[model samples]
Target: MGADNQFPVIQYVNEAGSLKQDEVKLHKEQLYQFYFMMVRARMMDKKCLNLQRQGRIGTYVQYEGQEAAQVGSALAVEDGDWMFPTYRDHAATMSFGHSLRNLFLYWKGRLEGSIPPEGRNIFPPAVPIASQLLHAAGAAWAEKKKNSDRVSIVYFGDGATSEGDFHEGLNFASVFHAPVVFFNQNNGYAISVPMEKQMKSKTIAQKGLAYDIPSLRIDGNDILAVYHETVKAVARARSGGGPTLIEAVTWRYGAHTTADDPSKYRDQQESEIRRKTTDPLLRVERLLKNQGWWKEEEKERMEAEITKEINQALKEAEKFKPADIDELFDHVFAEPVWPIEEQRKQHKRLSREGIQ
Candidate 1:
């Protein structure tokens, strides 16, 4: 009942570093892309954490242990596909060609960070939890109406499933056959409340059954599995096959956010153990070694290259102009309402008097 039995966890590669099928050939370049992005995602997370500690940025959400779930699924989506991400899905957004400098700007609390690259239909990270699901469904429905092949992939955590919008999104997608993939990264806990404490549903995938949608559970740490399964889901959606709910059961090694301590609720040692046993990057490296394609020079070069890129982006983010005081009042509504106007005036007056 704890682990999904009905929707058995699908995996292409096992923890021991062996591919499930001998015929599943992979090119070195493809593997490198997967490895590089996963590493980049983790590195970005680490850099942001350090910046937050140094007061260079605001509190950050870490997605260290869930890189495979994010990066693999991200790579599965096509260039023109839409991406709806949660705050913790920087890996996905980055893999989908989001600007690294802008991603840095986001944690710095600047509005510029919210914008996606030109031609890349990436939505700003929805911090309000499952609200993005409704948006994804709506966007997919729009595409369907237009007779386009575009699909929307929305990322949400397990906790979001309990929200009313989750059901609403799924129901709408089901009834209308919206081409949206409900990608759920079930990272055991929703901030702090563990899955068992919140819902009795044995698995998140089964929730899709109620809506009569195809669903599956996958080993989120297995990058190959994540990529392959997601490719199928995305392809299905693009082909007008309706929505697919994918529950990637993964783990987070660090605290929920810089503001909270995971140790208070969960044992930190378990994370250390999981690092050796199920770390996504390590699994890929193992696969490379098993395939006799593991090259130290290639890895070293990648590390250097990615480090340079991340540092350059960080510098660029730091070069941005200081946030304007008026930004707080700019976008509350198209035409300013009295409450927003009143608050703006009050804030300006307080600032002029050297008060917060």
Candidate 2:
């Protein structure tokens, strides 16, 4: 048997926009909603890249190619479910009702961006890799103890599997029957290091076998597959079926972040090829066209609407004052530690004296 037989990639729609699974019914409204969110996310990612180039935001992470994986998995969860996203998962957070203005403010390095809207259990982006895995596990375990049906979904990259927290989180969740979905977007590259160089595992989904967590690998670019798989995982978690690990096989079409150069490490031509063949948005578009649900005028209207929404969010983000230097020290503890207090005082004195 080939790899396809060994590690099956769940997909409802083929590249030609034909339904591979006849049992799965395609809803026009649902398809339109998915397309809208994907387009919105793509637009936001492009705008942020431009903002970074113009020095309007700090180093920004782009999520252009992974929209279907992010948006589909996010939309699968319920309203009260907790979301632990990485810096590259603003697409997911935005789909889960995170504010666009707050996302922009995060790239601007403001602490306020970390705060989710009222009753939204979205954690700030975890920049330290797999650390959020443990947090997600703990939160899920807590909800389990509370006898609540809520589940936690934690997003991470392929590189995070190497971290100790990854194993610890899975082991704990398995032992305690925690309701958490470990969502891994295998985007082929961990920064400049390709997946082949990173690990010997044939598939990231197989990693969960050791912990006895139910796991599967799916075609991340197929929005229907992603959505269906995640819905099942969420349902399993809610029904006391314990943890799940989903490895969404996808690709990144750009540099790891705005600060990096992809040309140095990867063949740019490969990304171009993937863009033409495996783009997430294009797949949805093709499916829509195949189903006779696509309208050029509707797409144009969506673009205009999304552009206006993003521009308004950008304006709101820009209106915020520059972050105060001392505000960082104040949040470290309820009361500032002596060393931090001293450093804050010294920095303030230097600023007053106009000294470097």
Candidate 3:
């Protein structure tokens, strides 16, 4: 199916900045905040890619074109809410108050990087794909049981929806009325497998219908739409309306990760085209201009400040010594089982032999 036949793209502002002009109760300050977050995210993504190239950080996942979807939904959550992110959703984690230094450390292969600051419930990125959905559903169910209004939001890619755990999670959440939002970023492809090859369903949002959950397909590039719709979904979840599934239709301008090349599977020209029209930052800039709140000077200043901040975070992350090889084996259990101890000793012997 072509992009147009997917669904009526949910949007509040056009690229030209002429708002639908209804009483949506949007404020200029809110729009500016969204714009700043998107810009910061884009800057961080670019920095990480460069750091990877410099051999400073490990392999990186760049979320260049998915800023609005991440920032918009992340900003909708309150401080007490829990966030479950995949390796590609760092923008959401950052917007939800995850430390930039820790994020950099995470890419640097430090386990400590996964630890959230005091009272923050951000989980480490789940690289095993949709496995985090079960955890999110369980956490939200426990919160519901405790009568707390806190909601849990889980981020996954379109490819993740095909995992058995995804269906299981939505089923469990629907049955238990768990306060969780399953944020599926339909970025056209899962690694190299396009959505059509990954699933038979025409639309990801429609997947939630099996479980009787409320779901919507939104134009993920539209920051305003992403934010408002997420705010409503989260509000509904908090008000005992159970889980909501949001399929944010967006694209990734870069390869799935630094380790892959897009030219191998798809056309790079499409990404270049996306840069012109569907770029998330451009849409926000368009909105700002429509409202006469955008300034070129302000954009340049913001970019400069963000670059400095990213550099400072990188410095902090690099200051820490590389993770101890043994530390990886020590954390799994209170008392290392005999099998683990044997493996650890074997690992040490191999290291002494200069095997790696």
- lDDT against the true structure, per candidate, is 0.94, 0.93, 0.90
lDDT of 3 by residue, 248-348 (tens): 99989999999999999989999999899888888878877876788999889988998889889889888999989889898889987998899999999
Q: Write the per-residue lDDT of candidate 1 for residues 151-190, one digit (tens) a residue.
A: 9999999999999999999999999999999999999999
Per-model TM-score on C-alpha atoms: 0.98, 0.97, 0.96
- Model 1 root-mean-square deviation: 1.3
Clashing pairs in 3: none
For 1-356, candidate 2 gives per-residue lDDT tens digits of 54446678898887778899989999999999999999999999999999999989989999899999999999999899999999999999999999999999998989989999998999999999899999999999999999999999999999999889999999999999999999999998899998899998878988898999998999999999999999999999999999999999998888899889999989999989988888999998999999899999999999999999999999999999998777878888887689998988899999899985
So what's the TM-score on candidate 2? Answer: 0.97
